[model samples]
Target: MNRVDRLHSPFEQHSRALAWLAVFGLLLAATNLRGGLVVFAPLVLEIREALSLSASAFGMLTTLPLICFAVISILVPLMTRFFSSITLVVFGLLIISLGVVLRLVASYPVVILGTLLLGSAIALLNVLIPVLVKVFFPSRMGLMTGLYSIMLSLGAGMGLYLAVPMLEYFGHWHYPVMVWALLPLLTCLIWLPLLKLRGEVKPVTGARVTLWKSATAWAVTLYMGLQSFYFYAIVTWLPNILIESGLNPLEAGSTTAMISLASIPFNLFIPIFATKMHNQRSLVVLISLLSFSGLTGLWWAPQLAPMLWAALIGMGAGGALSLSLSFFILRTGDGVQATALSAMAQSLGYLLAATGPVTLALMHDISGHWLTALMLLMLLQIFQFAFGWKAAAAVQIKPDINTHSSKRTP
Candidate 1:
């Protein structure tokens, strides 16, 4: 049997109602990953004015969480050794809740500290969610992945579209940030019941897979990094680009939300679509072109056709992000290996991504034109396409099957 066949033991049967409940729990957890990340961008100008932040300082606010993702990712796989995955996820949710509440303190240091806490918290789930699919839903990987990606995109959209109204009602940025805490709180209430689940695998004690030696793993990592770099950088600056191109603040904000909305359907569609094929090179090629077209359009004529460009990037980014998440399982042997590969990709991947916001800001600051930055983003899409295609190859990672089989409980 193939490595994929070996690592993916069938999920132990559960009641239909219980399976749906697990799906509910997965979707709930996925929602929090990108919700808070979107809150800051809409409030960027307000945050800068209120806090008296310099350009680079504001950039750091954007960069900090990604740095946290990188730093925290290094420890998550190891963390699974000591804690059950469900327990670790519960801890992550609480940390996210704490971080959200922390942002309400109205002090710079405290707010920064809160942001760090939640970013670190989200970082843990980032590694785990894909693993969840591998461990528990190997039979439903693509559907679950797309569903998870859609939930995250919706979270981002909620954070974006809801911010203005939230500002109107709450009368301050801090309150909206405070409102985000409710998502984790809600997810925790739902997830808490699952901790009592019987027959789940306990943490295994053994040597971990050495992923650094694998080319497909590195392909997954770079694909994750470059796609994140583009998505975060574009989301951060696209509003400003639209505003400069003659859109009003409201329109620019709306356009930004639309980009995320566009991605939603694509995110839902891509993984399921990609799974029907042997390799996803064609999907990668399509995304690269869509990305190139949309980004270049924004650079050259954003004012002339804002919705068109936004939709292009939206679809492109959505498919790309879903594909990247899909690779966590596609390239690895099982949920355990998925967690390890996730750690490597996201730890290093996010560090690479960490530079996107700050680096783009610095580039724009130096050049005084969006052209240079947009051009660079377009160029990177090609590079991203390379990694995406290779990572989608027919060959899978050659894991230590003998050791892993002995260690994992059936």
Candidate 2:
């Protein structure tokens, strides 16, 4: 058989069983994606005290992964030329496990090294998972995107909720962090079976598409960046905003939970719904309005209906994230193009995202209140709507690539 026929033969014969395996492995991998980074978040104070880190040092430790994401993502497309997406994912997970173990050594230099390794490993997974989705489940892009997107949020939530408990159970901050290594390790095992299927799926070799020069690619990148920025800033500051608005620590904590919880269902559904439509512009506008209205409520009268406002922001942020990810697949012609766009969007997008929390903090410091910061965020939603609208157009990165195998919902 020819190479194309060889690629199609196994899939055409055993599509159902292979698809189930692919979906399971993809979801399991998704669970490990964000959990490692967020697991560090809830353990921050404990880690800082244990490691004797200064506030700035601790901030850098937390920020390092985001910087890695921005830097490492740009290199993923290059790596694809040498390895299949599955191989990179498997290697990345093991590296993450090693990084987790290294951090438990309790030495400052060791911890920095470990954090760097963790960030670099995750950066690989971040850029390539969508490429896998496009390769294996092109026909169900929205459904698979939505499912993995929900898993990402689920993983983060589980990490946040479980981190302190793990610390208490192990009686050391190191052990709590170390225990998270189990996730990637386990996920690594789940993906092992897929390696044998690699013969059916090789990296796409084509004339390089210059994502940087495409206005549509830029639109997708900006949409991805602004939505990510809003998410990180709100997550970092919402509690403080609540406390400043006269709520007790307990109340603020509960409100934050409400925000996290509210996003789950929307994350579960929005991408699936978006893909079935003719275009996602309406969804983008809807998400921006929800975030804008929520931010307005928080700025003007947060005490009035905190839960309502929080939920709206959560839904908006969650939906925007899933939609932006969908753009990586929706806007591309094939898995190769998707990988390039995903790398470009995440590299620049996360570099922009890396600035989010710090910028908000700086604004609050300069203005002596969060009103200015909140207003700035509200203004950003306007730009998010504009870029997201352009990105939401029904088109492809390579118009000449045949799309018969991956038709959109009519």
Candidate 3:
């Protein structure tokens, strides 16, 4: 795709009102994505005992959303065939609201069903945001990314902090879970105007196309997956890990909150910083070392330097999250291919992430300690470093070379 094809307008930019609405809606929608998932971290132990579930079973609950992301990703290309990304986001918000309500039923089956629904809902937004950014904020991808990503970080941080308080005030877990339903509902109202602004036009020339010819695409995908692998694994188990090391539930939750907070600055600034640089390989290397040291410190001295280790992990891992999203646009030529690459990366990445919780939980079960599990996380950082080297290369993922397969993506 040339400059004209890559930069084609998805919506007219003459209306200041519509532009503001899109920005507002985009940030609000981002805030909702991780709230549904983060709510489980602070309450995992209470939830485990309440449900009478085994470690393995609880792991499944945490992993269900990622599993949903993986499964639903294959359908994204198909879903876009009928609906614009703006319209798709509205539908996602509705499904998330419905799923939040379903979670209040308190039955095991009902809760699992709700999780599946919400996970699938988040999957749509996760895969669609890059495409929408390409359409609406092409010239300001980094700044816009930082804005939405900070919201993601804040939502996640605040979610962990609010979980216990909400539980205390509501006197039950179900009510707190249902409160998030309002976010998406309000977001829907804000997003509805976007469809009118888009004028129902769609881009089809680059539809269903992928960057299979370039090795950078695979590198970006692997980096995305490996970072997610460590992140989800840590979030699901870190509180418990701290508790096992002698902290109370409050302290454990505090550490989790601190970790989330630490990542916020990085999430808000990494994209903008990256866009101004030659390559992000050095940033990746710096964060990897920080994460490696943090994980080591946690394993060796959980009580000592808890805040420092958490911050390091946050900058390393949380920073990785922003970088991964930035790479989607940075490494791709245009919005159309960015969508294709984002869909491919997130689909497989989250699927790869679905294993994090279970794998760590199982490792603990077999070894009777978190050492084996922590070591596994440490090893993943090395892999992330290797892949980030190529992904952060100064090249775009165009179809420069051919790599054939029996099947095609459409």
- The Cα error of candidate 1 at residue 11, in Å, is 6.6
User: Which has the greatest TM-score?
Assistant: 2
Instruction: Give the candidate order by descending lDDT.
Output: 2, 1, 3
Model 1 ranges with Cα > 4 A deviation: 1-13, 44-59, 172-174, 400-410
Worst 10 residues of 2 by lDDT: 1-10
Candidate 2 lDDT, 153-220, residue by residue in tens: 88888888888998898887776676668878888777887787666666544334467767899999
Strongest candidate by lDDT: 2
lDDT of 3 at 77: 64
TM values, all candidates: 0.91, 0.93, 0.89
For model 2 the local lDDT of residue 322 reads 91
lDDT of 3 by residue, 135-156 (tens): 6767777777888788887777
Clashes of each: 0, 0, 0
* Shift of residue 292 alpha carbon in model 3, Å: 1.5
* Model 3, runs deviating above 4 Å: 1-13, 41-59, 200-206, 400-410
Candidate 1, backbone clash total: 0
